[model samples]
Target: MHSLARRALHTCNVPRDLTQVTFCDSAGEHPDRVGLDGNAAEAVWRSVEALYRTGVHPGIQLSLRYRGEQVLHRSIGHARGNGPHDPASLPRIPMTTDTPICFFSASKAVTALLMHMLSEQGLVNLMDPVSYYCPEFARNGKRTITVHQILSHRGGIPAIPRETPIDVLWDRDEIWRLLCAAKPVEVDGAKVAYHAITGGFVLQRVLEKVTGDTIESYLDRYLRRPMGMKWFTYGIAP
Candidate 1:
């Protein structure tokens, strides 16, 4: 093992109870069935530690696997600020291996995977126009915009207007209506620009339309539940 992995292995605070490790198979009961490079695994942990030490992030929870078998799992640091939510704060609630962290834009990739699953089930087609699943999406000359374009960042509707109320984001109906009625900034599929938040909203509606279920429900039934995840969901319920 590399020095990095050795240090990580020696210092890692793996919880005593196997059940406390999130994302571990059988709660980390089985040994490695396939050989994994201890050095490489250690390097991954060292990198996370270095980032935390450098103030890049306050804490990290990482899990690594090889050939479908977990090789290394570690979690370290605080969940929040010790001082008010200010820069001067030190550490607060200690983060555990199982602490639930928000994915933010990382959730986009998850949504994309969900879309692929729906496509594989033959309930949705990437090549089809967005309007095929949600007819309101056809407004403002968007009838020609394909799901493929949206996923690829070529749909041309990148942002809702600046005049849109900030609070409207939490109101799904208002956000959906704004996106459906909004015009493309350029010709659809003519260019590539990150859609940021708009793509997710449109995709959510499309997925719900095809699956007859919300994105959260579809993920729970097909993804999270099968994987044995206890708390993963699209959003926390109010």
Candidate 2:
């Protein structure tokens, strides 16, 4: 195995007992919520505890709602500084229910939902090529890639080129330019390679082009603000 892979495996093999030391419970749980009994809620929490004991994840947070009421809102382990590979001398930052965790790929689901919502509003048709909305994406033989293909991980451009700088991610225009210029592995939507980070930008561009607004503003106006979310955003606020 590669040295880094071996190190990663070793780091993930945390002792079961260490979970107890690292565990931090949030005070936000509402076991007494009318439909949920304390015992039933504890059963669910115990299941979460069992997963935590496996030590694969350094931290976890859960907010489970039952019938429109939040029955469980809790977190466990360290958000930082207590990874299995870290030395014991480091100070642990306790994971809390309020911790600003990155949704990462989970944001893709939200983006997908937004796309469906846009379709419902007659903003863009899912089956239409993305180039129909953002003509720049038509470059480099991507002219026929549909919004649906991108949403489903079938759009051919799965990743940015290896030679690209990591910092280019924050430069939206530059990243889009690279994506526009990238050759597709295939454009027939016959494969299932995941786009990972690339699809989000493509979807964002289409959304912005159709709405004449930034994706963030569109999300805020349609979903975040209306849903009363405190911090479900693309990036952390400074």
Candidate 3:
């Protein structure tokens, strides 16, 4: 391991109370008694605990699994915040292994998986032009762009203009129109600039157009529901 990695691992010291951890098993066996190397497993726990103690990150919940067995499960710090540390001040909810946390841009993999599932089911083709499903995407010289290009971050529209309000990113129709009307920074499939957020909106619209269901609904039916995940969705209702 590099010095930096060693330093990080060494610096990660969790509070004594935070050390309470659990392991999930099929036959209700303890993780240590199951088959993982004790040192390796301890390292994973220490690393996750250390991340929570970094102070840069407010909280963390980490679970490691092998062959369908959760070998290590742990949570540390407050999901809300440390707050006043007094019961009278405010309620500081401590984070737990089962806490509902948002994945943010980490959600890209889930979105990508959804697209792959669609392709696997023969509902869409990765090689087909995106315009085949969402014809409006053909505007602004993007008629030649392929689904593979978008998935691989080669679809020219990595971002909307800087002046775009943060709120519009969630306004599906406005964001979609802007993306469709915008010109590519480079030729389709010629460069690999991660779309960051733009590609998700565009691809989501195309997905909805093709499947006749909202992206959220599609995910629930094809991914989350079957997998037994309840809280995973595009947005939380406030």
Q: Tell me each candidate's TM-score.
A: 0.78, 0.81, 0.75
lDDT of 1 by residue, 6-106 (tens): 34444333333423322322355223457556677768766776655443355677666567666666666666652223343443566666678898888
User: Is 1 or 2 the stronger prediction by TM-score?
Assistant: 2
Q: CA lDDT, every prediction?
A: 0.75, 0.82, 0.73
- Model 2 per-residue lDDT tens digits across residues 113-217: 989999999999999999999888999899999999999999999999998999999999999999999999999999999899899999999998989999899
Cα-based RMSD of candidate 3: 5.9
User: Which candidate leads the pack in TM-score?
Assistant: 2
Q: What is the lDDT, from 0 to 100, of the residue 71 in candidate 2? A: 72
The whole-model C-alpha lDDT of candidate 3 against the native structure comes to 0.73
How many clashing residue pairs appear in each of the predictions shown?
A: 1, 0, 1
Decreasing lDDT order of the candidates = 2, 1, 3
